[model samples]
Target: MIVVGAGPVGLTAALLLARRGHDVQVLERRTLPSELPRAVHLDAEAQRVLVDAGVDFAALSSPGAGLRLLDADHRVLAEFPREPGAAGMFHQPDLEEQLRAALARAGGQLTTGVGVVAVRPVRGGAQVVTDRSGDPVLAADLVLGCDGAGSTVARAVRPRYRELARPDRWYVVDLLAPAPLPVWPGVHQVCDPVRAATFMPVVGLRYRAEFRVTDQPLDLPAELARFGAQDCTVVREAEYEYGARVARRWRTGRVLLCGDAAHLTPPFIGQGLGLGLRDAHQLAWRVDAVLAGAHDALLDGFGRERAAHARALVRLAAFTGWLMTAGGVRAARVRSGLARLLPSTLLAAGTPPLRPGPWVRRPRVGRGHGVGRLVPDVRVRGRRLDDLLGPGWALLVCSTEVPDLPELPGGARARVLHRGALPDLGPALRDRWVLVRPDRVVAAVGPRAQR
Candidate 1:
């Protein structure tokens, strides 16, 4: 299999596929990994997906925290705790390094300094032509377009899909703060009539600021001054404002698209990267299953499931953008009234609040299947489920009479836990038998008698 793009989403998809024992090749145009911070947040769901892909979040830099919304004066309009299990402010470069390392450990092949010029479907496979030196043609049974918004693969599949146009434009500037500011660790948004600014603390004292420019031509110096900053050194800057858009179809024959190549959205909700990660996880499993002789119909579910999730995210992002960028007299009144009426906790309650910790354990049962799902990571009988599972199958025996059901065949491993031993298990595991997948999703839940 050939995957295009080496960003986090692309590398992640490659790693998952490689772990499933596929011969995966990752192609990228960049000669090296990026050093600048692009994305500022990773929600709980995305972090779980990374952990399941073999990433060690605990070992990375401490997560950035909380969300603070403010008006043009920098007065707090509302503050919300970042969702539980979400990553606050780690550098994008650092996160990408971790992902790249995981991909390496998983034995995936990564080709840098290579650009895919075009992709087309062939009999039982796809052919990709790249500008990398040496061989210009790469062949694989399947092609995955993980390339960003301007995706060549998506262009190739244009006849089968349509691209939606976004409505606005935004710019992001990453900086290395000479010193720490009084700003909170979480996200801070400063809203105004003509423009807005967003502050994100990456790691330590460094930070990233995103500015929404109303007019086409932007004055960087003036914008920086408006945000109450001066003499700040810029690390990177890029334009982002665009309305949400997605392909009509994700797959056309052996070639498919994932991540930004398949969809694009404003960063208002911070769901852009998270959605991309989900795309990787969803497609990886189905691709592996298909390669393993699973029915092709299983592949059909990828677009359906992802499209459902993406649509919701798109709407959420659009709503957030509209609220933050509201203008005119009525908008001003609405914004001011909301600022006065809501307390910080009430504003934040809509999203999961942040917790204090370097590593927050998620709840799980049995093994493999429960890892990715949201469960309190607690111990039963002095053993944490995460410690016991180690990326494998888990079996929870709630009944005294452990069913005479057959053990997992082949190399699969299983764990047995008594429901009576832990009171907490009563709620999450009511059934006598529960089977968890490697990623900690519940595969099967049932009574021992039924089994």
Candidate 2:
């Protein structure tokens, strides 16, 4: 398999594919990881991806308290507190370095400084033509374009995509904290109409602030001073424009797009990284199954499932951006009032549920709620639920006896849990069994186990 773009998403996909016994070569334009921070957040779902990919985050990340939306006067508008299994904040380079190491450890080939220039479909697969910058012509059974928004691979395969919205530009500043501040450990969305901004403390002694600014360049240090960050070391200062967009199609023959190559979202909701990682997670297993002789139709639903997810998140961020960065004082007031009335679950990160799809198979015996959602990790027999489930598909049975089930696409196991092991499983699994995918998504729920 040829995986384009060595960012987190691409590296992750390659690592997982290689782990599944496929040969993967990752191509990247940059020779090294970015010295400055890029993505600063990853929820538990992403943490799950990292664990599945064998990228350790214990040394790279810390828990975040979620987000706080505040008015221009620094008054709270809506606060989304981090739940028990919510996201974590980490340094992008640290996480990327770990991913690179894991890929190497998994025996996946990583070719840096080579950019994919063109992709052409061949007899049974696709050929990825690359720039002569590093590697040469590569042919593989599959091609995954995990490249960013300005994806050359995406353009080579398909020229057009739907632009969801016009971009909003913001100046981003990353500073090495000279010392700690008294601020809480979370993102502060300061909804100042004159200069809306976001501030957060990432892993390491790093602090980042992004401000909505005019096109004119300003003294970067002066801007940091305004944030009372003058004493800190400046890591990087640059302007970034973020908007909503999704490719008209994610798959063309054996070539497919993932991550920013498929969609782009404003940073308002902090889902940009999570969404991409989720893409890699959702696609890798299916690709492996197809390679292992499952029908190619197994992959037919990949683009649709991911496109809908990307659209939902982009729309959510767009709405959040309007409340925090755009609109007038009257709009802000109305938003504040609504925020007060909204439930914390609605406001919190990782609250949205994925809709049912071909991949998210649900049993017909019961309502089978939570079938499409990522299953929460719970303790089982003194070990983490995931640790007990191991890898691949798994069946968690609430009843005393484990039922015989048809073989899943990937091999699966049945683990009978103690009656009260998962209190949060709720009535969804009462007198039933839950089938979990390799990525730990609840694939199905039924009275008698089936796949």
Candidate 3:
């Protein structure tokens, strides 16, 4: 297997593939991880994936509290408190460095300074074409494109890049805190129509502020002063145009697209990187299943499920962008009122329920709606639910006896975790169990478990 563009997503895919006993090679253009700070957030789902991949977040970042909406004057309009989980605010370099190390430890080969021009499907598998002339074309059983927006591999597939929102520009600046500055300990969306912006305390000594700005250059000092960040020293600043977009297709033949190669989203809600990590997780496991002698239809199911998820998230980001920067002061006041009315679940960061496909069970089955969604990372006997399942498909029964294995994948009658240690698999439900996929997604609800 070959993974291109060894960013976090690519590294994660390679790591997972190698852990599945496959020969994996990761190719990257840069010899080392970039120090420039870009994405600075991740949710529990991403953290769960990283933990499965053997990346430690304790030394990289820490989770924080609160997601607040503020006026231009920095007055709190509405607030939603957040809880600490496996995820946290982290710098890009720290994450990539750890992922790279984990990939290496997983026995995946990483070849840096190599550029792939394109990938094509051959007779039995895929071939990777490189920029270097006279080099042999590399053949692989499978190829994954983790390349970014201008993905050459994705271009090879000739899929339409559907633009979901009008292109917009933003000036993002990362500042160094001279000391442990007494700043607000959470993310703040400055929902001012005239000057919409976001401010957050990044991990380490870093602070970042992004303003929805014109395409032209701006006086950095003045902008910092306006944002009341003049005291901090600038570490990095750049102008980037961002918007909501997703690929019309994710897979073509043996070459598949993941991460930014499949979708693009504005930074409004900080889901950009988390989406990619989730894509990598989904892609890795399904490919593993196919290679393990399962039917090839599992691969298509992976693409379908992921593309739907990516589209839903991009739409959410677009809607969130509207909520943060649309309308006048009167409209802002209305938003504040509406925010207060909003449920915490709506504001929390999590994946939407998947449609019925492959392992995803139909919804409205009794009272259990967990199918097609990630199983909660509940601790059973001091071990995470993920730790109990390990890296393969399993039957997670909350009952005394494990059920029959009709829903289990081919020859993969793996572990069974029962309620003896679970303590709580929903006290209200009777005769409940869940078939968990390798990605920890609830694949099916047990018989008679649904209402």
Which of the numbered candidates is closest to the native, going by highest lDDT?
3
lDDT of 3 by residue, 411-431 (tens): 576687764566555542235
Off by over 4 Å in 1: 132-134, 159-166, 216-228, 339-397, 400-439, 442-451
Best by TM-score: 3
Q: Considering lDDT, where higher is better, how would the candidates rank from best to worst?
A: 3, 2, 1
Candidate 2 local Cα displacement, residue 195, angstroms: 0.7
Worst 10 residues of 2 by lDDT: 410-419
Q: Report lDDT (CA) for all predictions.
A: 0.69, 0.78, 0.79
- Tens digits of lDDT, candidate 2, 1-451: 8999988899999998988889999989999777768898877877888888887776788888878887877788878888855778888888888888898988999988887778987866888887784556788899999888888778656836777777888989888887886677888888776678788888768999898886455566665565567788878888888878877788877788899998899887788988898989989888988787777776767887878778887888787777567776776767678766655653463635566776576666557677888777776657667776666777776656666666666443445554445645655566567777887788777673333
Q: Could you tell me which 10 consecutive residues in candidate 1 have the lowest summed lDDT? A: 353-362
Task: State the lDDT at 200 in candidate 3.
Answer: 84
Candidate 2 Cα errors over 4 Å, as ranges = 133-135, 215-227, 333-335, 346-351, 363-366, 400-407, 410-424, 448-451
Candidates 1 and 2 compared: the better one by lDDT is: 2
Model 1 CA lDDT for position 58: 55
**lDDT for predicted candidate 2 compared with the true structure:** 0.78
Q: How close to the true structure is residue 424 of candidate 3, measured as C-alpha lDDT?
A: 59
